[model samples]
Target chain A: MKRSICISALISTLVLIGLGTAAAEVVMIAHPSVPVDIVEAGMIRQIYMGQTTPWNDELAIAPVVIKAGPVRNEFLKTYIKKSSAQFSTFWKKAVFSGTGTPPAEQNTESKLIAYVAATPGAIGFIDHDTAAEGVKVLSIE
Target chain B: MTSAHKSTFMAVLAALLLGLAPQIGAQDIAIHGAMSQSFMQTSDNNYLVESEDGSFSIFEMVLNTTANIDAKTRIGAQIYGREFGHLGNNHMLVDWAFGDYRWRNWMGFRAGRIKFSLGLYNTTRDIDMVRNSILMPQSVYTEDFRNVSNAFHGFEIYGSVPVDRLGSFEYHASLGSAEVDEAYFLHDVFIKVLAAGGQIPPSLGFEANLDWAYSGSLYWNTPWEGLKIGGSFVTSDLYAEESFATPTATLDMSLDMDLKKLYVLSAEYMRDRWTFAAEFQRLFVDIVVPDVPVFVPDVGVVLMDIPADDRRGGYYGQATYRASDLLELGIYLSVFHPDWSQRKVGTAETEQKDTALTARFDLTDSWLMKVEYHIIDGTGDLPERLNPDPSQLVKSWSMIAVKSTFYF
Candidate 1:
């Protein structure tokens, strides 16, 4: 009976950690001026890679990224299908070749929101619950 | 005039310009420098005797400036220096000097010294942060050949055409006169005179190049993905001629030449962390010697030297894996071969095959380091001058270079 009680206690602790991680929400965001239908994962990949210059359907896709950090890694894996390091190297090569440039990086969540709000075609991400006015939430597949 | 005196005159002129120029529109100036030291141990000392001991320094400095000339145009300049072992005292005349007139998105022209947009790599050769590999692919840009020319003075017309769904097509066409300084001519005097009169000769060789690239994602289900394929080709005319008169006889000679028709084929695939690329290049040079007599002193006989034609081709394949934001690993192999049958005396030809392996790591956003080792196997039948001593064949060399770049 004591062993069963100890096992239950460990399981509850693990569940709490999982719940805390899930509670930290990430939201795809764009400038209010941009009329994007839904910022999907594939679209974000295209804009960041410079494959798509201007968005169609009355919108322009501008992407902003956070500098490499724990939050950046979690967001990229969940939305971009790649890690932060891979994206960096890919963009470095592109920039060196004069073929493309990576999306601008913001140092903090507030900075990201400010940049996206001011830039007409800019897009970025932040904690879903913290998203303020002048930014639209994009859908992630 | 002595080189020192010429350099002094240039320095004085630069000082005068900076002192007297109007300050109303003066732009900011910036200075940058890099110092690197590396050591290596090799089995043989034949390739670079000084390098065999394995310690060297490669240092460089760049003076850059920008002036806001007007709303539509901006002026910029860069002066660079390098010191690499005994091959010290290297300089760059100008990275680029051009005026852009953007009348509209569909039409634009730039005139002055400009970078050759022949391939994806040529335009950004100077920016360290943007390149995919530590060193440029040799097949297209022969950085090893000390005098390999990368930029030309000329005019270019470029524009983009928008498409409905497939994305737009961007195009560039340029025409420019090739420039070769006195130093470059002196280096090639023994074999050929590639320039005349401190500038390109009056014949003023011309170059024309074209590039077509498409940008857009490839999948219908995922329309926002990005993929691009670009290719470029350039051709130029090179000419040199001279005549001599002697008491015993009169010798007249002329060479109407079309050489170094360079073509590059490149494709890049980038999705998330993996990037793959391949490049193939072909270069051809035609040499025509008109009735040049070769005299045999012992037999009192004269024989006309026959002209020859030579061709060279090279290819490279590269792959890179990004472990994280701070570290990247890359491996590439390249092969270069020349048609030995077409070689002539006093010419630039590779009698043997050359293969190289290179690895690069990015320690940080501002620092990059790379190491490359080369194996050169000389063909026994190389031209006499190229291999003055046949024993100098089959050599190997290893070089490690590190660069730290910063931008503000």
Candidate 2:
């Protein structure tokens, strides 16, 4: 019985480790030309939802997104308060209705960083460990 | 266009789209498209067409592009094709083209052929993947009037205001006019419905000309996590020129139809995997037919004056649940009153109630399939083309629809 218990414990530990590796830390980033270095959670949600179109009365809000993955899921839950499918449907409605368009999507961390840094008023997220330059890190409150 | 021509055109366009797919690789320019084909069947009467026999006649496709012409300006347009039974007839047309300018978060302007902001779902009524049902509620979104209600050629001012404690407030105000074809108004709506027990002679028709129109909406995002409330209003004036021939007389007439008011109150609450929504809509239409002289067999000249006033309204409550990542379920109860304060049109008041159940399956990230069933208790909202004789309309009926959509 003791041997069986030890084996069970080991399997549980392995499963937990796998899950831990799956989770990712997401960091919001923006172009250096953007006026703000921090954004409220609500503000992030609004900008992504196409509800808020401009920032600081000068900078037009342009949001970028990942096509899919855990980082996208984390960003959606934390800032947009939606699931990936829900976010997709929301943007689909907006786009088809002539109200708004979905944000640009990047397939790789490097491309995401490059787009956010190069385009003024652009915002996006990447894995926290991804090395990024020429972009401002936004603190989400 | 003929079905053969439309088919060839669609094939060519689809080939062109395949060629253009690889070029949409930039942030400043985007291309999107969606296509859906649906099959529908109704019991007893034809709704939209002779659907009682079950038809695969509904098709829709849209290709749209948006280009950011700077930081503050964007220009976009959509080319749409649809075959809604006898309505669209596989015609391809410009759905909307607009230039948008944003000054700030609180102010923006859009000018061109702009979609009218109606109820919560009016703007996206034709988009299949966005909604859970095959057909949107028909009372408020009368399929026959889409030509007048869908979009207009003009401008709009829109903006959203952020509140401290409350969530936010958004508003859209627009002024425009629409050009409607005689077939849209005369052949589809008036001729079918107003001819009583018989069909209108082929020689009788009317041309609908809109003078002006205005519409607006106000929306509030409440403090509650996922709750929203809003209201909308629309009004327009239409001038119609009519020509008719009877067995013994020919008549020419000019009429005025004033869409006095159309307003809707909407609310929605969403949490977790569940969404609840409700909306109430009311509409008023006044028609004035000036006295026209017509020759009669017995009387040399007779003056015919026909006037009509319509009071219509509807309400619907719906609930939807995301059963899983790949599946969704929805149920709704919709009620309509064609003329609430009337006493004499038929044996009973014209009221329609529909209870609908729907299921949607996400086949893939870019594809979806949906099926819906409706149990209807009245025919007040039934189109005349489907039921040539109102007296033959059954009080109880059922309908089933299935659709598949692909998008990118």
Among all windows of ten consecutive residues in candidate 1 chain B, which has the lowest summed lDDT? B212-221
- Place model 1 in a CAPRI quality band: incorrect
Residue B182, model 2: lDDT of 32
lDDT of 2 by residue, B93-142 (tens): 66777778876678899987788899888888888888788988776777
- Give the per-residue lDDT digits (tens) of candidate 2, residues A1-141: 999999898656643532332567899999988888888888888889987756665566779998878898788877777767678889998787666867888888888889998888899999898888989899988
Chain B of candidate 1 vs. true chain B, TM: 0.67
What's the lDDT of the predicted structure labeled candidate 2?
A: 0.77
Model 2 clash pairs are: none
| Clash count of each predicted structure | 6, 0
Candidate 2, position B313, lDDT: 83
Candidate 1 collision pairs: A85-B324, A85-B325, A95-B130, A96-B130, A96-B131, B217-B225
